[model samples]
Target: MSNTPIIEAIKLSKQFTKDGDFVLNSLSLSIPKNKFTAIIGYSGTGKSVFLRQVLGLDRATSGIVRVLGKELHNMEPAELNAFRKNLGVVFQDSALFDDQTVLENVCFPLKEHKRSMSEDKRKAIGSEKLKLSGLNEEHFNKFPEALSGGMKRRVALARALVLEPKILIYDEPTTGLDPVLKQKVDELILTTHKRRSSSTLVVTHDLPSALHFADHIVMLNAGAVLFEGSVSEFLKSSDNLVATFREQGLNKYGKN
Candidate 1:
Protein backbone atom coordinates (compact mmCIF):
# COMPACT_ATOMS: atom_id res chain seq x y z
CA MET A 1 0.00 0.00 0.00
CA SER A 2 1.14 3.50 -0.73
CA ASN A 3 2.22 5.60 2.23
CA THR A 4 0.43 8.64 0.79
CA PRO A 5 -2.67 9.76 2.59
CA ILE A 6 -6.07 8.82 1.24
CA ILE A 7 -7.49 12.00 2.80
CA GLU A 8 -5.73 15.25 3.58
CA ALA A 9 -7.01 18.40 5.22
CA ILE A 10 -4.74 21.40 4.93
CA LYS A 11 -5.59 24.28 7.25
CA LEU A 12 -9.25 23.39 6.80
CA SER A 13 -11.84 25.68 8.34
CA LYS A 14 -15.61 25.92 8.20
CA GLN A 15 -17.84 28.72 9.50
CA PHE A 16 -21.63 28.73 9.36
CA THR A 17 -21.93 32.51 9.48
CA LYS A 18 -19.68 35.46 8.90
CA ASP A 19 -19.41 36.25 12.60
CA GLY A 20 -20.08 32.77 13.94
CA ASP A 21 -17.28 30.69 15.29
CA PHE A 22 -15.58 28.34 12.88
CA VAL A 23 -16.71 24.77 13.26
CA LEU A 24 -13.36 23.61 11.87
CA ASN A 25 -10.68 26.02 12.93
CA SER A 26 -7.76 25.57 10.57
CA LEU A 27 -7.58 21.85 11.26
CA SER A 28 -4.95 19.86 9.44
CA LEU A 29 -4.39 16.11 9.27
CA SER A 30 -3.64 13.21 6.96
CA ILE A 31 -5.47 9.90 7.05
CA PRO A 32 -3.16 7.13 5.88
CA LYS A 33 -4.20 4.91 3.04
CA ASN A 34 -5.53 1.39 3.74
CA LYS A 35 -5.45 1.91 7.52
CA PHE A 36 -8.03 2.12 10.26
CA THR A 37 -8.25 5.64 11.69
CA ALA A 38 -10.45 6.67 14.57
CA ILE A 39 -11.44 10.31 14.84
CA ILE A 40 -12.33 10.98 18.49
CA GLY A 41 -13.66 14.02 20.24
CA TYR A 42 -16.37 15.38 22.52
CA SER A 43 -19.65 16.62 21.11
CA GLY A 44 -19.58 19.84 19.04
CA THR A 45 -15.83 19.58 18.57
CA GLY A 46 -15.85 19.40 14.73
CA LYS A 47 -15.47 15.63 14.26
CA SER A 48 -18.66 15.50 12.19
CA VAL A 49 -17.81 18.81 10.57
CA PHE A 50 -14.51 17.38 9.44
CA LEU A 51 -16.36 14.38 8.05
CA ARG A 52 -18.70 16.67 6.11
CA GLN A 53 -15.74 18.49 4.68
CA VAL A 54 -14.22 15.20 3.58
CA LEU A 55 -17.47 14.05 1.99
CA GLY A 56 -17.88 17.44 0.29
CA LEU A 57 -21.33 17.79 1.83
CA ASP A 58 -20.12 21.06 3.33
CA ARG A 59 -17.60 23.38 1.77
CA ALA A 60 -14.83 24.89 3.79
CA THR A 61 -14.78 28.54 4.77
CA SER A 62 -11.08 28.51 3.97
CA GLY A 63 -8.24 26.08 3.22
CA ILE A 64 -8.58 22.78 1.43
CA VAL A 65 -9.67 19.15 1.71
CA ARG A 66 -8.32 16.53 -0.62
CA VAL A 67 -9.80 13.03 -0.84
CA LEU A 68 -8.52 10.35 -3.16
CA GLY A 69 -5.96 12.88 -4.41
CA LYS A 70 -8.57 15.35 -5.66
CA GLU A 71 -9.37 18.65 -3.97
CA LEU A 72 -12.97 18.39 -2.77
CA HIS A 73 -13.86 22.08 -2.87
CA ASN A 74 -12.71 22.39 -6.46
CA MET A 75 -14.72 19.47 -7.83
CA GLU A 76 -17.73 20.24 -10.02
CA PRO A 77 -21.11 18.78 -9.04
CA ALA A 78 -20.94 15.81 -11.43
CA GLU A 79 -17.27 15.39 -10.65
CA LEU A 80 -17.97 15.38 -6.95
CA ASN A 81 -20.73 12.86 -7.41
CA ALA A 82 -18.37 10.56 -9.25
CA PHE A 83 -15.74 11.09 -6.60
CA ARG A 84 -18.20 10.10 -3.88
CA LYS A 85 -18.63 6.65 -5.41
CA ASN A 86 -15.21 5.80 -4.08
CA LEU A 87 -16.51 6.30 -0.55
CA GLY A 88 -18.89 4.20 1.53
CA VAL A 89 -20.43 5.66 4.68
CA VAL A 90 -22.32 3.95 7.51
CA PHE A 91 -24.38 6.56 9.32
CA GLN A 92 -24.90 6.82 13.09
CA ASP A 93 -28.57 5.84 13.03
CA SER A 94 -28.04 3.08 10.47
CA ALA A 95 -30.26 5.18 8.15
CA LEU A 96 -31.87 2.10 6.70
CA PHE A 97 -35.11 2.53 4.79
CA ASP A 98 -37.90 1.14 6.93
CA ASP A 99 -40.03 0.40 3.88
CA GLN A 100 -37.36 -1.65 2.13
CA THR A 101 -36.25 -5.17 2.84
CA VAL A 102 -32.63 -5.71 3.81
CA LEU A 103 -31.80 -7.03 0.35
CA GLU A 104 -33.49 -4.13 -1.39
CA ASN A 105 -31.76 -1.61 0.86
CA VAL A 106 -28.39 -3.11 0.07
CA CYS A 107 -29.19 -3.12 -3.65
CA PHE A 108 -30.21 0.55 -3.71
CA PRO A 109 -26.70 1.82 -4.37
CA LEU A 110 -26.20 -0.65 -7.23
CA LYS A 111 -29.48 0.54 -8.72
CA GLU A 112 -28.36 4.15 -8.46
CA HIS A 113 -24.77 3.82 -9.62
CA LYS A 114 -24.71 0.64 -11.64
CA ARG A 115 -27.52 1.37 -14.01
CA SER A 116 -26.14 -0.96 -16.65
CA MET A 117 -25.99 -3.82 -14.17
CA SER A 118 -28.65 -6.51 -14.43
CA GLU A 119 -31.07 -7.13 -11.57
CA ASP A 120 -29.62 -10.59 -10.98
CA LYS A 121 -26.13 -9.12 -10.78
CA ARG A 122 -27.27 -6.46 -8.36
CA LYS A 123 -29.00 -9.02 -6.17
CA ALA A 124 -25.98 -11.26 -6.23
CA ILE A 125 -23.65 -8.43 -5.18
CA GLY A 126 -26.10 -7.28 -2.53
CA SER A 127 -26.45 -10.77 -1.10
CA GLU A 128 -22.68 -11.21 -1.04
CA LYS A 129 -22.17 -7.91 0.79
CA LEU A 130 -24.96 -8.61 3.24
CA LYS A 131 -23.35 -11.93 4.07
CA LEU A 132 -20.01 -10.24 4.46
CA SER A 133 -21.57 -7.86 6.97
CA GLY A 134 -22.78 -10.87 8.99
CA LEU A 135 -26.41 -10.82 7.87
CA ASN A 136 -27.50 -14.19 6.62
CA GLU A 137 -30.07 -14.99 3.94
CA GLU A 138 -32.77 -15.30 6.62
CA HIS A 139 -32.48 -11.60 7.42
CA PHE A 140 -32.45 -10.54 3.77
CA ASN A 141 -36.22 -10.33 3.43
CA LYS A 142 -36.86 -8.53 6.74
CA PHE A 143 -37.65 -4.83 7.00
CA PRO A 144 -35.51 -2.54 9.10
CA GLU A 145 -38.38 -2.15 11.60
CA ALA A 146 -38.29 -5.86 12.26
CA LEU A 147 -34.59 -5.93 13.10
CA SER A 148 -32.77 -5.11 16.33
CA GLY A 149 -30.44 -2.12 16.61
CA GLY A 150 -27.36 -4.23 15.92
CA MET A 151 -29.01 -5.93 12.96
CA LYS A 152 -30.03 -2.58 11.56
CA ARG A 153 -26.44 -1.38 11.82
CA ARG A 154 -25.26 -4.53 10.07
CA VAL A 155 -27.67 -3.84 7.24
CA ALA A 156 -26.40 -0.29 6.96
CA LEU A 157 -22.84 -1.56 6.79
CA ALA A 158 -23.82 -4.05 4.12
CA ARG A 159 -25.34 -1.29 2.04
CA ALA A 160 -22.22 0.81 2.45
CA LEU A 161 -20.00 -2.07 1.33
CA VAL A 162 -22.19 -2.86 -1.69
CA LEU A 163 -20.40 -0.15 -3.61
CA GLU A 164 -16.98 -1.77 -3.08
CA PRO A 165 -15.58 1.59 -2.07
CA LYS A 166 -11.88 2.26 -1.59
CA ILE A 167 -12.62 4.18 1.59
CA LEU A 168 -15.17 3.31 4.26
CA ILE A 169 -16.41 5.87 6.76
CA TYR A 170 -18.51 5.27 9.87
CA ASP A 171 -20.30 7.94 11.85
CA GLU A 172 -20.88 7.23 15.56
CA PRO A 173 -21.41 3.57 14.70
CA THR A 174 -21.88 2.36 18.27
CA THR A 175 -24.00 5.19 19.65
CA GLY A 176 -26.85 3.33 21.38
CA LEU A 177 -25.64 -0.26 21.44
CA ASP A 178 -25.03 -2.29 24.60
CA PRO A 179 -21.48 -3.37 25.43
CA VAL A 180 -21.82 -6.73 23.72
CA LEU A 181 -23.33 -5.17 20.60
CA LYS A 182 -20.69 -2.46 20.55
CA GLN A 183 -17.89 -5.03 20.61
CA LYS A 184 -19.58 -6.95 17.84
CA VAL A 185 -19.83 -3.83 15.72
CA ASP A 186 -16.19 -3.00 16.43
CA GLU A 187 -15.09 -6.47 15.42
CA LEU A 188 -17.29 -6.33 12.34
CA ILE A 189 -15.63 -3.07 11.31
CA LEU A 190 -12.14 -4.53 11.76
CA THR A 191 -13.12 -7.67 9.89
CA THR A 192 -14.46 -5.67 6.98
CA HIS A 193 -11.38 -3.46 6.90
CA LYS A 194 -9.07 -6.45 6.82
CA ARG A 195 -11.16 -8.26 4.26
CA ARG A 196 -11.60 -5.33 1.90
CA SER A 197 -8.22 -3.66 2.50
CA SER A 198 -9.93 -0.30 2.47
CA SER A 199 -8.90 2.81 4.28
CA THR A 200 -11.42 3.14 7.11
CA LEU A 201 -12.31 6.29 9.03
CA VAL A 202 -14.55 6.19 12.07
CA VAL A 203 -15.94 9.22 13.86
CA THR A 204 -16.98 8.06 17.30
CA HIS A 205 -17.17 8.84 21.01
CA ASP A 206 -16.77 5.17 21.89
CA LEU A 207 -13.25 5.49 23.20
CA PRO A 208 -12.66 1.84 24.05
CA SER A 209 -13.80 0.71 20.62
CA ALA A 210 -11.61 3.33 18.94
CA LEU A 211 -8.54 2.28 20.88
CA HIS A 212 -9.26 -1.35 20.27
CA PHE A 213 -9.67 -1.09 16.48
CA ALA A 214 -7.85 1.96 15.20
CA ASP A 215 -4.27 1.77 13.98
CA HIS A 216 -4.15 5.56 13.96
CA ILE A 217 -5.91 8.08 16.18
CA VAL A 218 -6.89 11.72 15.78
CA MET A 219 -8.44 13.77 18.54
CA LEU A 220 -10.16 17.04 17.82
CA ASN A 221 -10.82 19.90 20.20
CA ALA A 222 -12.65 23.16 19.45
CA GLY A 223 -12.44 22.49 15.72
CA ALA A 224 -8.70 21.86 15.70
CA VAL A 225 -6.56 18.75 15.97
CA LEU A 226 -5.32 18.23 19.51
CA PHE A 227 -3.35 15.10 18.67
CA GLU A 228 -2.69 12.66 15.82
CA GLY A 229 -0.48 9.59 15.95
CA SER A 230 -0.28 5.85 16.52
CA VAL A 231 -2.40 4.38 19.33
CA SER A 232 0.59 3.89 21.64
CA GLU A 233 1.95 7.38 20.94
CA PHE A 234 -1.48 8.79 21.77
CA LEU A 235 -1.59 6.88 25.06
CA LYS A 236 1.92 7.94 26.03
CA SER A 237 1.56 11.59 25.08
CA SER A 238 2.31 14.14 27.77
CA ASP A 239 -0.16 16.66 26.27
CA ASN A 240 -2.63 17.83 28.89
CA LEU A 241 -5.64 17.63 26.59
CA VAL A 242 -4.80 14.09 25.51
CA ALA A 243 -4.13 12.99 29.08
CA THR A 244 -7.43 14.36 30.33
CA PHE A 245 -9.31 12.81 27.40
CA ARG A 246 -7.61 9.46 28.04
CA GLU A 247 -8.49 9.58 31.73
CA GLN A 248 -12.10 10.44 30.97
CA GLY A 249 -12.28 7.58 28.45
CA LEU A 250 -10.79 5.15 30.95
CA ASN A 251 -13.20 6.28 33.64
CA LYS A 252 -16.26 6.05 31.41
CA TYR A 253 -15.33 2.67 29.89
CA GLY A 254 -13.72 1.32 33.07
CA LYS A 255 -10.64 0.28 31.08
CA ASN A 256 -7.10 0.77 32.28
Candidate 2:
Protein backbone atom coordinates (compact mmCIF):
# COMPACT_ATOMS: atom_id res chain seq x y z
CA MET A 1 0.00 0.00 0.00
CA SER A 2 1.09 3.56 -0.73
CA ASN A 3 2.11 5.83 2.14
CA THR A 4 0.17 8.60 0.44
CA PRO A 5 -3.26 9.34 1.88
CA ILE A 6 -6.36 8.91 -0.24
CA ILE A 7 -8.41 10.74 2.40
CA GLU A 8 -6.99 13.34 4.82
CA ALA A 9 -8.74 15.20 7.62
CA ILE A 10 -6.92 18.09 9.26
CA LYS A 11 -8.40 19.48 12.46
CA LEU A 12 -11.87 18.71 11.20
CA SER A 13 -14.81 19.56 13.49
CA LYS A 14 -18.57 19.45 13.22
CA GLN A 15 -21.49 20.58 15.41
CA PHE A 16 -25.09 20.12 14.41
CA THR A 17 -26.43 23.10 16.35
CA LYS A 18 -24.98 26.39 17.60
CA ASP A 19 -24.86 25.29 21.23
CA GLY A 20 -24.29 21.60 20.67
CA ASP A 21 -21.03 19.92 21.54
CA PHE A 22 -18.83 19.03 18.59
CA VAL A 23 -19.71 15.73 17.00
CA LEU A 24 -16.24 15.57 15.53
CA ASN A 25 -13.79 17.58 17.59
CA SER A 26 -10.84 18.83 15.56
CA LEU A 27 -10.21 15.30 14.35
CA SER A 28 -7.19 14.75 12.14
CA LEU A 29 -6.45 11.49 10.36
CA SER A 30 -5.28 10.02 7.07
CA ILE A 31 -6.35 6.86 5.27
CA PRO A 32 -3.57 5.30 3.18
CA LYS A 33 -4.09 4.44 -0.46
CA ASN A 34 -4.84 0.81 -1.42
CA LYS A 35 -5.15 -0.20 2.21
CA PHE A 36 -8.01 -1.59 4.26
CA THR A 37 -8.43 0.82 7.19
CA ALA A 38 -11.03 0.18 9.86
CA ILE A 39 -12.32 3.03 12.03
CA ILE A 40 -13.63 1.59 15.29
CA GLY A 41 -15.14 3.12 18.38
CA TYR A 42 -18.11 2.95 20.71
CA SER A 43 -21.41 4.21 19.41
CA GLY A 44 -21.79 8.05 19.32
CA THR A 45 -18.04 8.60 19.20
CA GLY A 46 -18.41 10.21 15.76
CA LYS A 47 -17.44 7.30 13.55
CA SER A 48 -20.35 7.86 11.18
CA VAL A 49 -19.90 11.63 11.45
CA PHE A 50 -16.32 11.29 10.24
CA LEU A 51 -17.59 9.27 7.28
CA ARG A 52 -19.84 12.15 6.29
CA GLN A 53 -16.86 14.51 6.29
CA VAL A 54 -14.86 12.12 4.07
CA LEU A 55 -17.77 11.78 1.64
CA GLY A 56 -18.47 15.54 1.60
CA LEU A 57 -22.05 14.81 2.56
CA ASP A 58 -21.97 17.49 5.27
CA ARG A 59 -19.92 20.63 5.87
CA ALA A 60 -17.45 20.82 8.69
CA THR A 61 -17.74 23.36 11.50
CA SER A 62 -14.01 24.06 11.12
CA GLY A 63 -10.84 22.66 9.56
CA ILE A 64 -10.61 20.77 6.28
CA VAL A 65 -11.13 17.40 4.63
CA ARG A 66 -9.31 16.37 1.48
CA VAL A 67 -10.19 13.34 -0.62
CA LEU A 68 -8.01 12.31 -3.55
CA GLY A 69 -5.98 15.51 -2.86
CA LYS A 70 -8.94 17.85 -3.39
CA GLU A 71 -10.53 19.89 -0.62
CA LEU A 72 -13.98 18.31 -0.22
CA HIS A 73 -15.81 21.17 1.53
CA ASN A 74 -14.56 23.73 -0.96
CA MET A 75 -15.56 21.93 -4.15
CA GLU A 76 -18.18 23.37 -6.47
CA PRO A 77 -21.38 21.39 -6.96
CA ALA A 78 -20.41 20.17 -10.41
CA GLU A 79 -16.88 19.44 -9.28
CA LEU A 80 -18.09 17.55 -6.22
CA ASN A 81 -20.53 15.55 -8.34
CA ALA A 82 -17.68 14.61 -10.67
CA PHE A 83 -15.45 13.71 -7.74
CA ARG A 84 -18.14 11.50 -6.17
CA LYS A 85 -18.01 9.22 -9.19
CA ASN A 86 -14.68 7.97 -7.83
CA LEU A 87 -16.34 6.86 -4.57
CA GLY A 88 -18.66 3.97 -3.70
CA VAL A 89 -20.49 3.74 -0.39
CA VAL A 90 -22.22 0.80 1.32
CA PHE A 91 -24.59 2.23 3.88
CA GLN A 92 -25.37 0.61 7.25
CA ASP A 93 -28.94 -0.18 6.28
CA SER A 94 -27.97 -1.49 2.81
CA ALA A 95 -30.20 1.29 1.34
CA LEU A 96 -31.48 -0.87 -1.47
CA PHE A 97 -34.48 0.48 -3.32
CA ASP A 98 -37.36 -1.80 -2.41
CA ASP A 99 -39.15 -0.86 -5.63
CA GLN A 100 -36.24 -1.79 -7.90
CA THR A 101 -35.08 -5.24 -8.89
CA VAL A 102 -31.60 -6.42 -7.82
CA LEU A 103 -30.19 -5.78 -11.28
CA GLU A 104 -31.82 -2.36 -11.47
CA ASN A 105 -30.41 -1.38 -8.07
CA VAL A 106 -26.91 -2.39 -9.13
CA CYS A 107 -27.27 -0.52 -12.40
CA PHE A 108 -28.59 2.65 -10.75
CA PRO A 109 -25.25 4.42 -10.60
CA LEU A 110 -24.58 3.76 -14.28
CA LYS A 111 -28.00 5.11 -15.14
CA GLU A 112 -27.41 8.30 -13.18
CA HIS A 113 -23.80 9.00 -14.15
CA LYS A 114 -23.23 7.18 -17.40
CA ARG A 115 -26.49 8.09 -19.05
CA SER A 116 -25.05 7.86 -22.52
CA MET A 117 -24.07 4.21 -22.08
CA SER A 118 -26.35 1.67 -23.68
CA GLU A 119 -28.79 -0.22 -21.41
CA ASP A 120 -27.33 -3.55 -22.49
CA LYS A 121 -23.82 -2.44 -21.50
CA ARG A 122 -25.03 -1.24 -18.11
CA LYS A 123 -26.81 -4.53 -17.45
CA ALA A 124 -23.72 -6.43 -18.51
CA ILE A 125 -21.57 -4.55 -16.02
CA GLY A 126 -24.20 -4.83 -13.29
CA SER A 127 -24.49 -8.58 -13.86
CA GLU A 128 -20.72 -8.94 -13.61
CA LYS A 129 -20.62 -7.09 -10.29
CA LEU A 130 -23.52 -9.08 -8.87
CA LYS A 131 -21.75 -12.35 -9.68
CA LEU A 132 -18.55 -11.01 -8.17
CA SER A 133 -20.55 -10.22 -5.01
CA GLY A 134 -21.63 -13.89 -4.85
CA LEU A 135 -25.13 -13.50 -6.21
CA ASN A 136 -26.44 -15.90 -8.84
CA GLU A 137 -28.32 -15.11 -12.06
CA GLU A 138 -31.66 -16.11 -10.51
CA HIS A 139 -31.40 -13.39 -7.87
CA PHE A 140 -31.09 -10.64 -10.49
CA ASN A 141 -34.78 -10.31 -11.20
CA LYS A 142 -35.91 -10.38 -7.55
CA PHE A 143 -36.74 -7.37 -5.38
CA PRO A 144 -34.91 -6.49 -2.16
CA GLU A 145 -37.81 -7.66 0.01
CA ALA A 146 -37.56 -11.15 -1.43
CA LEU A 147 -33.96 -11.61 -0.27
CA SER A 148 -32.46 -12.53 3.09
CA GLY A 149 -30.40 -10.09 5.21
CA GLY A 150 -27.14 -11.52 3.86
CA MET A 151 -28.43 -11.41 0.32
CA LYS A 152 -29.41 -7.76 0.72
CA ARG A 153 -25.95 -6.92 1.97
CA ARG A 154 -24.43 -8.70 -1.02
CA VAL A 155 -26.65 -6.74 -3.38
CA ALA A 156 -25.60 -3.51 -1.70
CA LEU A 157 -21.97 -4.51 -2.17
CA ALA A 158 -22.65 -5.33 -5.82
CA ARG A 159 -24.09 -1.85 -6.35
CA ALA A 160 -21.12 -0.26 -4.66
CA LEU A 161 -18.73 -2.14 -6.97
CA VAL A 162 -20.68 -1.30 -10.15
CA LEU A 163 -19.05 2.13 -10.34
CA GLU A 164 -15.52 0.71 -9.99
CA PRO A 165 -14.70 3.40 -7.45
CA LYS A 166 -11.14 4.14 -6.36
CA ILE A 167 -12.32 4.50 -2.77
CA LEU A 168 -14.84 2.26 -1.04
CA ILE A 169 -16.52 3.39 2.19
CA TYR A 170 -18.57 0.96 4.26
CA ASP A 171 -20.71 1.95 7.24
CA GLU A 172 -21.45 -0.84 9.71
CA PRO A 173 -21.35 -3.46 6.98
CA THR A 174 -22.02 -6.37 9.33
CA THR A 175 -24.46 -4.71 11.70
CA GLY A 176 -27.21 -7.31 11.86
CA LEU A 177 -25.49 -10.44 10.59
CA ASP A 178 -25.11 -13.73 12.47
CA PRO A 179 -21.57 -14.85 13.33
CA VAL A 180 -21.13 -17.13 10.33
CA LEU A 181 -22.67 -14.61 7.95
CA LYS A 182 -20.60 -11.83 9.45
CA GLN A 183 -17.42 -13.78 8.80
CA LYS A 184 -18.50 -14.41 5.25
CA VAL A 185 -19.19 -10.70 4.71
CA ASP A 186 -15.84 -9.83 6.20
CA GLU A 187 -14.09 -12.29 3.92
CA LEU A 188 -16.01 -10.98 0.93
CA ILE A 189 -14.93 -7.44 1.75
CA LEU A 190 -11.27 -8.44 2.07
CA THR A 191 -11.45 -10.43 -1.15
CA THR A 192 -13.05 -7.54 -3.01
CA HIS A 193 -10.41 -5.11 -1.73
CA LYS A 194 -7.63 -7.39 -2.96
CA ARG A 195 -9.35 -7.95 -6.28
CA ARG A 196 -10.00 -4.25 -6.94
CA SER A 197 -6.92 -2.89 -5.18
CA SER A 198 -9.07 -0.01 -3.92
CA SER A 199 -8.52 2.19 -0.91
CA THR A 200 -11.12 1.04 1.62
CA LEU A 201 -12.34 2.70 4.82
CA VAL A 202 -14.76 0.81 7.03
CA VAL A 203 -16.48 2.42 10.02
CA THR A 204 -17.52 -0.39 12.30
CA HIS A 205 -18.16 -1.28 15.92
CA ASP A 206 -17.03 -4.86 15.30
CA LEU A 207 -13.56 -4.81 16.81
CA PRO A 208 -12.90 -8.47 16.07
CA SER A 209 -13.68 -7.99 12.41
CA ALA A 210 -11.43 -4.94 12.29
CA LEU A 211 -8.58 -6.78 13.96
CA HIS A 212 -8.94 -9.73 11.63
CA PHE A 213 -9.13 -7.89 8.31
CA ALA A 214 -7.67 -4.40 8.56
CA ASP A 215 -4.25 -3.37 7.26
CA HIS A 216 -4.48 -0.39 9.65
CA ILE A 217 -6.67 0.20 12.69
CA VAL A 218 -7.89 3.49 14.15
CA MET A 219 -9.68 3.87 17.45
CA LEU A 220 -11.77 6.91 18.28
CA ASN A 221 -13.10 8.37 21.54
CA ALA A 222 -15.14 11.52 21.96
CA GLY A 223 -14.58 12.32 18.30
CA ALA A 224 -10.76 12.19 18.44
CA VAL A 225 -8.32 9.44 17.60
CA LEU A 226 -7.25 7.43 20.64
CA PHE A 227 -4.97 5.06 18.75
CA GLU A 228 -3.78 4.61 15.19
CA GLY A 229 -1.47 1.78 14.05
CA SER A 230 -1.18 -1.79 12.84
CA VAL A 231 -3.38 -4.54 14.27
CA SER A 232 -0.44 -5.90 16.30
CA GLU A 233 0.31 -2.46 17.69
CA PHE A 234 -3.32 -2.03 18.63
CA LEU A 235 -3.35 -5.47 20.22
CA LYS A 236 -0.20 -4.75 22.22
CA SER A 237 -0.80 -1.12 23.14
CA SER A 238 -0.34 -0.03 26.76
CA ASP A 239 -2.72 2.88 26.59
CA ASN A 240 -5.54 2.42 29.08
CA LEU A 241 -8.33 3.15 26.62
CA VAL A 242 -6.84 0.85 23.99
CA ALA A 243 -6.30 -1.90 26.52
CA THR A 244 -9.80 -1.63 27.89
CA PHE A 245 -11.31 -1.58 24.43
CA ARG A 246 -9.26 -4.58 23.38
CA GLU A 247 -10.28 -6.51 26.46
CA GLN A 248 -13.93 -5.72 25.92
CA GLY A 249 -13.68 -6.78 22.30
CA LEU A 250 -11.97 -10.04 23.25
CA ASN A 251 -14.54 -10.73 25.95
CA LYS A 252 -17.38 -10.13 23.54
CA TYR A 253 -16.04 -11.65 20.33
CA GLY A 254 -13.24 -13.94 21.55
CA LYS A 255 -9.59 -13.66 20.35
CA ASN A 256 -8.52 -12.63 16.86
Encode model 2's per-residue lDDT on 1-256: one tens digit a residue: 3566998889989999999999899898888889999999888999998898888899999998899888988889888988898999999889999999999999999998999999999999999999999999999999999998888999999999988999999999998899888988899999999999888999988888888889999998999888989999998899998898888987887673
Clashes of each: 0, 0
Alpha-carbon deviation at 232 in model 2, angstroms:
1.4
The reply for model 2, stretches above 4 Å from the true place, is: none
lDDT of 2: 0.91
Give the Cα error of residue 13 in candidate 2, in Å.
0.8
C-alpha TM-scores of all predictions: 0.97, 0.97
Off by over 4 Å in 1: none
Q: What local lDDT does model 2 show for residue 56?
A: 87
For candidate 1, give the lDDT: 0.92
Choose the strongest candidate by lDDT. Answer: 1
